[model samples]
Target: MNPSSTLSLLRGICAAALLATATSGGPAAAESWPTVPDELFAALGLERDVPANVLYDAVAARFHDQDQGYGKGKFADLWEPIAISRYFDPGLYEGRDNLDFEVQAGECASCHESVTPGWVHSWDNSVHADLDAIRALPEDDSRAYKKEHLAEVEANLRSMGLLAEGQPLATVGCADCHLGVNVKAGNHKTDLRLPDAAACGQCHVRQFSERESERDTITWPQDQWPAGRPSHALSLQANYETAIWAGMTQREVAEGCTMCHTTQATCNQCHTRHEFSAAQARKPEVCSNCHNGVDHNEFENYMLSRHGIIYQANGDKWDWDKPLSEAFASAGYNAPTCQTCHMGLHGQPTHNLVQKVRWGFAPMRSIADNLDHPFFAERRELWVATCSQCHSPSFANAWLDSMDKGTEQGLRVVEQGNAELKAMYDEGILIGQVTNRPAPPKPDEDAPGGFFGLFWTEGNNPTAIEYRNAQMWEQQLMRQFKGLAHANPGGFTYTHGWSELIGSVAIIRDEATRLREFRELQAKVRELENAADR
Candidate 1:
């Protein structure tokens, strides 16, 4: 049988086994049964006094069904996660729901110290394992805002039966996660490696939820398609192709854009797996995968800024693993990284990147339409507060506002360039063509009239010549948005982006007009020759 078919058969067998066990009994504590409504047991056709072990087995069938759903979520990485979740929920854990796993954490550490020394060392120093330094800060400390998020994480875990609600929450230790009650010591048969982002979501819920959220592909990225511009397949949740190559949805960019999108999740996109070090996560390089190069060059733009220069100069001496409680205090570090602006020690340590920007790269629509709106206002407020940590509010706000206006100015320039392209397209000069390649087969060759639209629309021509025309159109516009957004005014702004944008539009129009006139002259010659022959 085929691989997918074989995997499907195996899953069917597992479900059958779980269902057989579930029909017999489930794991339910007897003393706790009295608190439950008798109607619940009646619905299942079970006795009210069913033990927790019996109740657990009876629910295994449903658990299996639920586990199967993970293999088919929107995320591209689900196969391993579903299998790992089965290990987490053989439904065998039984004991008090102790939230703090300090003693258990030590036991977990004792054995792994020899094998994974580096990972063990990283985990020991990780914020997940300890936050004592943060707790030491005074109650009024601003950076301690992460405490509420941590508490919220513990609460979410407890509600999901992963942690105990009664005890005080601490930094999530290894034991809190590997919480299997009957898991044996030196259990050589069991797999301890559960690195699924879904598993982590029970605790770290917010960021996990945000991984495949809509904001990921909100506007546009480098659209040099058919000429091959990079795109976020997972984030955009679409199949895309380009001129030079194809794109993959997998974490790795294999085979140079041959476009093989896979079932990989963006969960470990930032946090990574295993040791899950906050120190590594805090680095600006983490944001580079999705936020760099071509049109979206904020990460590169930042490198050109004074902040990048400072980090390059004196960052090695600075501590990256500073506690949340002290992060806002700004230890004697000379420069800031991308994290300092977006996820910085501002009062809020959030995963929402949009909260840090007022103008962003594409404020064309937002500035004109939603400038004074609440969402835009809220974002500016957050940015102002974050910037105020370093620069004075007046200085920061004025600087940020000037950028917003710059973006607005950039949009006006784009509108001008757009008008030039629209005129060419409307005048039977720059024709509509599919940007995708291996371009879809051309519509009826003898078709008479032209279609109005050019952007991924039906009934449009798909010629190599047209594809080149579209590429010219797509790339020139990238400068206006990409340059203004990155704050890199030299190359991306006037030099390459906006200044060249106007020039490119004119060149395309002139070429398109030349092509149209040549075609007309050829048709006229054909007409004269036919009349002479008649």
Candidate 2:
């Protein structure tokens, strides 16, 4: 028989075995099953009296039907039957009411299967599953830390108001964030639920809230900071607050998840179809939606970098889908994708590179622990191997060293600038008397646009003007950084370099202030000489 036929035959045998176990009054009888222990039940927010065997039988039956006697077919199709069965039958597990859990879990899984199937599989492999076959082998210190940290994270979630007041953390499963309800005409309108901004915010509150506070006074950084200009500092702050905060429904905050998770093109926006590979997730383009602007120009930076240039120029000649080989020559350009630097390939018989590397773009320090194991100590060695994909080992090393040095120098400049600013502020050099402080007459009021007539206007201050200019300059500098990092020429020149020039303009304004004072002093001296002559 062919491999497919052989697989189908094996599945048939397994199905028969499952059926025999379920029906017979043998040792596998469901009635004699062990019940879920009170402790475990309590932890899962389930009733202790629940019978584990009944749930197991239901799950086994569903599994058998879905597999069709271990039939050779598409894995997704096979999973569908199991998903449907599990959704309809709550008795697939012990400890709790099957109906309630299944309803929520089913809805979440069904929607995600349509939108992000790969993520659904990834989540299944995640720590969420409770199957004995999938359990990690417990070592002494490792098990202890896992338990402690899990508790810590759960506590953190509760404190952040992501969970209900008395809800157990285990019960805070997939639905807490991903599910949405729509009420219209005093009846349910649509029950379409997908992971949205509010869902991500439940866990990533700090990231979501960082740009919302104290907008008016908070100055943009000098590297990307504005000098003498009018303040529009509150623009981003206002938008985020109004859209994410004041908006009443899930649709209101829909932009949040899409802003970071997708791009302007293609089905791969969430995850690629077919294999739904993990490799695609590590690419920078996935984050282009939100990071395309002046400050966080990850897309621009990656595109302009040597790696991006090489890929763009030569990708057609190489098999991008296959695992990268050491001897593989680049068609023309010399660099790898964002994945090359971060997620190492599987075929290369070296240490796991993804584990050891710390790409600290986001402030979150949470990382998968498998990377730190002793067996993966050669992660740095693997990272070096990535550089060798394009340039010689020596050249790659030197380039990285130079980049590091440049970063250090840039940081130093920022520190020095900040120190000077602090000194000036502390000495009260910024305060001054102005010649005019009059309240200007109001303009003739126009009719309200629609219903709301929200309107206001005010004259600008010199300091405020300078600050706004500095803000624009700051934005430009950030754009330049993105361009340089991504290897995108346009971003490097227009966005990144242009921002630097604007920043220079702001600096000139500061210098001009001192020059103006000097000119006034010279004019006074000339007048005094003329008076003496008279």
Candidate 3:
């Protein structure tokens, strides 16, 4: 049957009810349908009654398939959010409601097993589905190391006073993570929410604390950049505050920025859903999704390097389920994965990837020798210790020195390009500088449009020379430092780093010369025309 045509039938039912009341000599009611009551709307902070006209229009539109005369009552008022906030969920911003998982836990699996067979199937295979399986394994199990790790996690939970003494461990079912362990939180159908980082932290205390430590890092200059900034702790906020990300009208493109930044939202980005296997996240392939690109190609650099070559050849043979700390011996790994190198600190692996970060991919100015700074020197020493695991102390130190020198040279070249552009900008001779060039996106104070201008453009504002300089600083410089840091010699030299920097430098110089000559020529033409007229 046609959905829209049914709206007339729905209206007829309401009209008949109204007519019956009138003929019986009873007073007519203001509302004909029991949509969302005014009390419910008031509780949601919408401060308005559901209008009969809105109900009639919603029935005609057929917004939802099971249109119960008024079509998804709460969702019908799409405009209500504009007056309050961007997000429309009623209980979303409110503090989490406590749950009674022990009593209500089996309810979710029993229903979803039939409703969403796939969800149930995946959950059935996961360790979260049954902790008894882990407990049943023998003490001398081949993967006995993992059993030990689980014991530690269980003990940690007990220490937090969350896991009560003698309370037998429960399976980490849907409610355990999505809702809490014990209280009156509603049913799964209505109370389900997107679990935040804090929810995961509740159970996986060790991993959660390590990831959250990014907030307390003392790496960057505190006066300039925020302490946790350029780290995963602040990734989502950084995306939201980015000028181009906010200014762009294309919401799809903006959402792409959040794709990688979702790490701040959920553990599933790396761990993934259903299985959420540690072995899968241990592989370098997981990091490749976000880490490969023009700006920061750490994945590409690693793949091309000697370390990546070894992993690609023999990674499958190795046991990835083993802890990252034991990748070399227990896992039979000859070469380091991205996790082994970055997350591996002092022979132990951690979730805080930024703990030992120095010269964080792209530093704007010419930090000639970061070692001079005591904080950076300390981090370099930690890296030296990490590298010394495979190579001699002398060899590790020498390679670091080379990377530092290469980065210093790259920074100087970028600084020279910036100087040239700034000179043009100061002289007020840059193309479209005074006439057509509009300001760049907000929060970025680059008057000459260097870094922030690269994301967006207006007219000829960041003219040819300006664009060349911006690319040199943003893209080429990033490749140079990151390529060196990742131990990809060819990456830093010819592939995408040093060679690209040199090419950009030449282009900037050539563009600057041409622009100056063109400006001089225009002045000469104007002078010649004035003389002829006289």
Maximum-TM-score candidate: 3
CA displacement after TM-score superposition, residue 443 of candidate 3 (Å): 3.9
Give the best candidate by lDDT: 3
TM-score of each: 0.56, 0.38, 0.77
lDDT by residue for model 1 (1-534), tens: 998677646744754454333223232133332323343345346575655434433333322343322232333332122223233222222323342233433476676799667777877766666766554654335334445445545544444465454554556656455543222332223434344434454455444433322223233222212111122213212222121112122312322221222212224556654456666777778777656655456677666666666767777777675543235344445555666666542464544444334444334554455657664676677767767776788977786666666656556655654555555455554444324223332321212111111232334443333433343334444444545444566645656555665565566556666768876997999999999999
Q: Report the lDDT tens digits of candidate 3 across residue range 329-357.
A: 55788888888888876677777777677
**Backbone clashes under 3 angstroms, per model:** 27, 37, 5
Give stretches of model 1 more than 4 Å off: 1-160, 163-194, 205-266, 344-346, 356-369, 412-479
Give the least accurate 10-residue stretch of model 2, judged by summed lDDT. Answer: 446-455
Worst 10 residues of 3 by lDDT: 63-72
Q: Could you arrange the candidates by TM-score from highest to lowest?
A: 3, 1, 2
| Better candidate by lDDT, 1 or 2 | 1
lDDT measured at residue 519 in model 1 versus the true structure, 0 to 100: 66
Q: So what's the TM-score on candidate 3?
A: 0.77
